[model samples]
Target: MSPTHTDVPMAPAELDPCGMPDHPDCGIRDVLDRVGDKWSVLVVVELASGPRRFGELQRAVDGISQRMLTLTVRRLERDGLVTRTVYPTVPAQVDYRLTDTGASLTHLVKALADWSLRHREAIAASRHLYDQTHPDHDIR
Candidate 1:
């Protein structure tokens, strides 16, 4: 008889105090490092709408340099989150679009953006209070 699903042993759900796995090869940590980057998040959000050309992405992302955008998209493509297509035009146009996995992450990204907009004022106030309380400790 074949072993049932429940009969299979499972690895312990071990995590540190911060809720992250203690192992260096943790998949969650790798993904978070990729998507949690400021440039990656912005690029993914822009691609969420539809396919866009290299110049369009550079402009829409605001303050991202050409080299940085190139590196960011390459990383996203390597991770299977984005696709790059080249058109056989005189200038050789290139476009970027999110894969299904990347699209799925958009919802969470939008929620985080909304939350930031909502609490920005409160966060600024908190920062001011902290600065006032810790004048000597303020780095800036």
Candidate 2:
């Protein structure tokens, strides 16, 4: 007789002995990596206001390179988080806006930003103290 669903063993890649995902590039990790990227976070925040052109995003994101911004937007597009609209003007303008899914994520992102702002001073002070005590491992 064929094994039942419950009789089948879980794939090794699905979980480790500790019941955690075994693969480094698991779905959750992949999503987290994209969402947690600095450029992606900033791009998402900027798009939260409304649709914006490429140049506007470049300017708004502060230090992102043209190439980096291009990659970030493409990744967001592929992930269904942003939509790119092309306007057939003389210069062929392109604008990016958050999709519904992306918009939903903005609330969580904003909360995280708010939390960072609230704790930044304490975090900085802790970092400074740590750096002072561990001069050999000082990051600054």
Candidate 3:
């Protein structure tokens, strides 16, 4: 059987006595640096339901370009957040599943998704107000 979600292992670290990371450039930011890319987060969230084939993932991730998705999945796999499997069919097919470590992140991704949904209206209103006040600025 595949490992359960709770078996996901937390990254071991060398932290200071203050329960902080020892490196000057360490801390949550370091993690964000790895998984913070929007595509990576989306991929994790997408794989939460179960393993998905490459095309399914690309479709489910919405506007992500194929190249971007490939890079994102590769990065996540490199970081031990995902596992890729290839089937030896007449036309070999590949699928990606979250490792135990990656499964642990699903809840956080869900929370983030929930928060975004809840705040969508407020965010749009805020953007409208900002645009009205700064019509001369390029919002993009």
Candidate 4:
């Protein structure tokens, strides 16, 4: 039998891992890739409370380098998930906030955060077991 259009082998949906047929062109993967990094998630959560200036955000998301923060913000801005506003002043103030779409993703992000909190002990245990097994390997 010949392959029907629906039966033809198609590529895995690049955008979403869910592979739903309806969202053929969804940019969800690109969006996830952009925001999947740790610093991005931290920035999003920090901005969820309210808009923050660059330096303030840098301070709030501890351990993030200036370069990484700048890169993460730029990626979020380019993906339309975050908004950046600049004010003309002697100090040249700039602020970042989440877009509506980004706001919608907060539930998912929080769910992940909740899971992380719940599993921290288990994760630590697993890390301890692995470290014992691999001796000399630093799994930080």
Per-candidate TM equals: 0.81, 0.81, 0.79, 0.75
Per-residue error at 100 for model 2, in Å? Answer: 0.3
Candidate 4: stretches off by over 4 Å: 1-28, 136-140
Q: Order of candidates by TM-score, top first?
A: 2, 1, 3, 4
Per-residue lDDT of model 4, residues 45-87, tens digit only:
9988889999999999999987778778877786678999999
Lowest summed lDDT across 10 adjacent residues in model 3 is found at: 1-10
Model 1, 1-44: lDDT tens per residue?
23352232333444213345565545665578779999999999
User: What is the lDDT, from 0 to 100, of the residue 26 in candidate 2?
Assistant: 40
lDDT of 3: 0.83
Question: Which is the better candidate, 2 or 4, if ranked by TM-score?
Answer: 2
Candidate 1's TM-score reads 0.81
- Model 2 global lDDT (CA atoms, 0 to 1): 0.85
lDDT of each: 0.85, 0.85, 0.83, 0.82
Candidate 3, 3-121: lDDT as tens digits: 34223344555422333556564455666776778899989988999999999999999999877787788778877899999999979999999999999999988998899999999
lDDT of 2 by residue, 96-135 (tens): 9999999999999999999999999999999989988898
Q: Cα RMSD (Å) per model?
A: 12.3, 11.9, 8.4, 11.7
Q: Candidate 2 — which residues are off by over 4 angstroms? A: 1-26, 138-140
